[model samples]
Target: MKSLTFLLVFVPLLSVCRSQSETGVDEELGDEEHVELFTTATTKLAAATSDFGYNLYRALASQDASSNVLLAPLSVSTVLTQLSMGASETAERQLYRALRYHTLQDPQLHNTLRDLLTSTGTTGKGLSTAARVYLSRRLRVKPEFLRLVEQQFGTAPKQLMGGAKDLKDINDWVSQGTGGKVQRFLTKPFPRNTGVNTVSAAHFKGKWENGFSQSNSLESFQIDGGTTVRVPMMHQDNYPVKMGVDSDLSCTIAQIQMQDSVSIFVFLPNDVSANLTTLEESLTAEFVQDLSMTLLPAEVSLMLPVLSFSSTNELQPLLADLGLSDWLTSPGLEKITAQPVKLGTVNHKVVMEMVAEGNRYASSTSPPSHLALRVDKPFLFLVRDESSGALLLVGRMVNPKNLRI
Candidate 1:
């Protein structure tokens, strides 16, 4: 179980049309003062990294049950908790029970995952995540496990000066930690007693506090109740999202709103040949933070679908069939190098971009009234951090002509 190669690239820029008279009431009291600045240990590490990102997206969607899935489960759970700071106690108890975090305790689980990766790398928050640890320049690490993985993931550990400039310096540090949207993340090379290697990258490009209404009239989409496809749809009328339904996962949840606080929920699945396996086994993290606090705000009439795609996955036999077989068979990192190492080849990559721009303050001829919410077909999306609810990316989108361009 040492295969691990997960990659995802999605492009879906713009589309979120805000209006309820431009969200006033001091923006709902600034979202209740941004949920009182989160911190019951960063809300239990964002509900244990979103319940380990919905159990790693239901073990990678039960192995291709119709393809299309994405990941960044908080950058693969922060590179397995920074390689469990040089794991040992049976691979740090199988990486804290496969990252549900074994009921988080020790040092409040690395200071609440370094304050949830410094509030999801703040600065304009289009979302960003990075993790690294590549040794093997003739091993000999353990300087207190590189000072506890550079004091809880601020980065540190770069030795590998082997072949081809260590694959172009690990693909130029994953294209500058994904700001370049994950270019050439080691297309090939590095697999010959590769002592140790762990890299994680996540990049998101959704910035729509309000915008949408681009239509070249393609529509059609329903890839299920007897296949169809036309794509290129993004529109809005009243738009001011946050809707709900759920009848126990029958689906149809919305939530949209992106810009600094970041939130995109979308579930869909009413039944276009429904089979999202009970909405992907009814996701967790306290049921998606109580369905994002009981979604309500309305004024809909939206239609989405301009999504772009890219996915390349291996995921170490789906994380050793999800029980994490001793973290890929016998991983006692030996404090990251005592002439003995185990876990190797775990490269993860993700990139996203979503599209439709045009809300310089609404009035793009706002006419159509209430309830419409059309998202054509197969769906499931999540990309939160609504001030610390954290699950940074998780997707499904079944098909949009599988756009990899």
Candidate 2:
């Protein structure tokens, strides 16, 4: 029952959240103590996902060694200086939450993912079969998630929607569950789709021990493709920090650990935005060798924004990309049943979202994750693993239920 309750909590964390043509809601990121606790939540959730995804996300979480080819904006010496002041806590909290949302456990999302291997017959051959088999292991982690999806087949059926909610029920769940952080990822109103749809969502709220000084005002920034935009970047004079480099090639990464274990890493491109590629490419397990160990001290400055995202994508591409091709087809999937189970192949779909409270971007290509994607225009976001650095889920959400598994 406790396990089921945990799965229930992720539903409201919509990965891609759509701006509802309005913004002024009373949102709070909680106090520092509460914020620290989220780090614990994020770490546990990330671990759970790693187990369910079977290290698929673990690969992405790894950050590679820093290379000369990718000169960083900040030096190891400077980063270490900041770390000594104790900033890693904040970064850890952020990383933990991001990983949690990236972990994918929505009912609608599960349906789409389940289909990749839900073969009607035992033609289990190739990657499809493998994926389904691997995913079946999640039955225990997502007992309720499965039942909820099964329920979508009917109402309070003698069965649960794979023991999870149906696509139809997602809207109501998101509206109130996430403090309204997630609303309409579902495109359709109340109509239920005959096809099974898996669902996933995420919500994040955090406050800075110190708010941005409105006086910091506007700043000019360079982005990828050599474009520049005027952005209202936040300014934090001497934020807490942590840093270290185990070896030369193994670049030092600084962090701000939130209460539990979640953390944040700011990748400052030497050329502002030119190194965005490095930031992305270096976000893998093999590359993460340096980060797994080593610690140092440093002084810091921070720019962050308030961000929210919710999205939907076919699970095929993501799974295949993650070395789980064997599970994308029939016979590759698993049947989660007990009694006169009428259930067969299981497909999976996912949605994830998060929010940050801070500021800026190095460039257009590497848009500053300002923690502030104000509701000026309907925007998009993703909850990706801070470890393997893989995108657990992505979606452009206007409707919280806009799923395509």
Candidate 3:
């Protein structure tokens, strides 16, 4: 089965993260063409966000209500920061928006989100707690909403080739895209949804524009769970990295060139393996602003799932935790456009499914393959585009149950 997915790399841009009393802060002083490219990428990314928002809506619509499944959103920048301690909100959003563009590029995958949602029972929250109210009716319109997503994505879908290795490509792109907040999503068995088709891309890669020493990999390392993993940790010396609003937040990034529009980015929170939700919620544009204003370097130690993997999730409540107020059950899907009639409620809905396997592969009894690490907890993550900070696909693995794919 051909991998039906998208891919790209991410780069941070000069955008005002927070207003400063300083004079030159608001102005973006970068190569006009490069900035333009990032701008176009952002446009594609915003569209991708719309697509993922809708796709997630479908995923929520299909979930079994009894599971009490939920999802959470983290600013793309925060996770990248935690991973390697480097990146920006605009850059992270570009990563997310890219995922959206990737989805828009493929009609089969885009439409598939609807099919899987259409088959499930509706029971749960919407993108927002309020959105969940629309489940009954919205669930009925998944096919329609999905159609809307395809139409919204526009003629670009025609440009995508069905035979492309979508998941891997997308993952590679995202790795390069975010400088690597997301290293790899699924590489082994391509993640089986068991019930429907699902595709996910996760990646993080970089060589320290200055190249970290491989000798550092020999150091004894600290794993969040209290056990020490003698990791082959790579170290970058005296790297020019950024600091977040608080001294607690910091980041470092590695640029990956080639194959796909992607990069390898890492964020290092004050505490490695800190509670991600708290970390995400704690993120503020102002803090990011502070981060962009300063740069310094300290010895860095990194430990992550060195491989890719996948799972399943009921992401509604999880979304509620993040701040997506009304896309799901909020009377209607969240309004995409506002003509200023002061729209009350846009008819909205949500549904979810794990996109994995093909007609040929689904029927086979293949052994479950393995990657380097298992996603067992919540961590800020994304698979995004290089040109735009838009998230092609967004997720938080608060729990591995969501990794069933």
Q: Which window of ten consecutive residues has the lowest lDDT sum in model 3? A: 125-134
lDDT of 2 at 82: 18
Query: Which whole-number lDDT from 0 to 100 does residue 120 have in model 3?
Result: 17
Task: Give Cα distance to truth, residue 86, candidate 3, Å.
Answer: 38
Model 3 shows how many backbone clashes?
A: 104
236, model 2: CA deviation in Å?
1.6
Models ranked on TM-score:
2, 3, 1
Worst 10 residues of 1 by lDDT: 1-10
- Per-residue lDDT of 18-102 in model 2, one digit per residue for the tens? 1222222324433223112113333333333333342322232223222111110111111111111121344323322322323
Model 3 lDDT, residue 140, Cα: 25
- For each candidate, the alpha-carbon lDDT, in order, equals 0.73, 0.30, 0.29
Clash count in backbone of candidate 2: 161
User: After best superposition, candidate 1 residue 109: deviation in angstroms?
Assistant: 19
TM-score of each: 0.34, 0.44, 0.36
Clash count list over all predictions: 11, 161, 104
On a 0 to 100 scale, what is the lDDT of residue 72 in model 1? 74
Candidate 3, 1-405: lDDT as tens digits = 110111111123232232222334335653223122222333433444434443453345334322222232212222211211111333333333423433345434434333322221122101111111111111222344334434532211111112235445544544453334444433332222211112222222211223323332333444466654442333322332222222233322212211133222233334546644443443322222222223222222223332123333333243432333332223122222111111121111112232111122122133322211112222334333333333323334322222222
